[model samples]
Target: MMSCSNERQIITNAGFLAVVASQATAGFLSAIFSIIVLRKCGNLHVHQNCKILIVSMVMLYIVHSVSITILQTTQLIRYLTYYDPCVVGLSTVICFCLRLPASVCTTSFASLLFAIVFERATALWKRGKYDAYGPQLGYALVTISIIVSLASTFWAVQKVEFDQHSVYCSTATSQTADRVMLLCFLISGVNIITLVGIIALFIFNEFALSRREFDLQSSYQLRENAYVIRIMLPLSIFQAICYAIFSISSGLISLFRDKLSPVQHKTLYTTAY
Candidate 1:
């Protein structure tokens, strides 16, 4: 048997371990799915520009997932060794440099997911000439998404200055926690909207549009665009679920913050991150 403090320490360690495991699993799965999509996009029969948009979104998500896993793993190790598990031990410079990439990529991923659905909608609507002019629009959307995502996270980055005197470094800190929560909420809303809209579009096109007669070539193109949208539907739903989970977890952390022990708060915050 152990004392109460010892038992608490064990639980804390377990929580950190769980966060690490989940991050690792998420990174691995994202990598696998991204690779498969990259290989199969040529067969999707959508415009080449649409395919470019899809590939860009996947690349963003894969980098986001991998960077998040790496950051959280370091957080776990730092939490275990540091006196204050609620805060990180890395210097402000190192932490900012390490965390900035993941933060930027994650925001870009969410923004780009919305962009992908919007592009597909346009491509479907302008099926006749989309293949010719769509690439420029695709490139433009990608640029806009990166700019928007970076702007969204710029507020958080301002908090990432070097402070040697008793400075704490994780996103778990208040300086960043609010911004993170807001971003999660945005991601969750974006994903849910896209998921519902994608499903509705798919059903309408498959049943309503398919029932009508059209020229052979035009009908075939319509069906191919539908196929592209159909394949992306699952991905949209997956993103919705993942972001919803993160948002809910972050909400729970806020609701129970004052009531929770430092260990519990840290665990929840780190997990949500």
Candidate 2:
């Protein structure tokens, strides 16, 4: 059997490095992606609302990447140098440090995507007048998304009791701590719905295009909606996969945590990270 201290040593040296590398790579790619979107979409004259939604997503990705990198790298150095103990679940301090901000960015991005779907559907109800939609509507959707994200995030984590001074950490804390899984489940569910909603919107647009002819303006709007879906679907799929893994793994850990051995606990937490 491995000593507890030795197990910690192995994970700190091996795992944190991988975590840091992944965050750095994610950040770099997000920055490049943002630049490309700005350049290409500017040339294409995509509407202000579409630009706002796309830019908001890229910004969230960049922020999430930076925050995770710093949090992981700081914890990595601390564990490597004997300044912080490596716990099976993250140390309370590290979890507290990264939880809120990262979760907010994640929640906000998904919320914005949902808003896009809602806004497009509403625009269609406006029919020929959809062309008159203004940037204020875009701003309003973005504002609503941010507010809802903040509210949902607070609601999800309300039960997690953080002890800033405690080095001890485990899968089980307050009985209410299991509630954090709510956030994971909610985000995962929302992403899945976003995926389905966007696909349906695209299909509807294609069907409309194929069947009856429309005025030049309505046809252009329909085609534009479909084009936006093409660009956004890859992102929807990626987020869906990411959140599904997070929610499933976290749910499993919460449910079976009592049965897991120390090594199993550590392995699950590390992978979920």
**Index of the highest-lDDT prediction:** 1
Query: Please, what is the TM-score per model?
Result: 0.80, 0.81
CA shift of 205, model 1, Å: 2.2
The regions of model 2 sitting more than 4 angstroms off are 1-41, 83-97, 165-176
| Pairs clashing within candidate 2 | none
Model 2 TM-score (2 dp):
0.81
Per-prediction backbone clash count? 0, 0
- Tens digits of per-residue lDDT for model 2 on 172-201? 245435556776678788998999998888
Model 1 CA deviation exceeding 4 Å by range: 1-12, 25-29, 40-43, 76-88, 164-169
**lDDT per residue as tens, model 1, 186-258:** 8788888888778766765676465676555456556776887767778787778877887898889888888
How many clashes in candidate 2? 0
Report the Cα lDDT for residue 163, model 2. 52
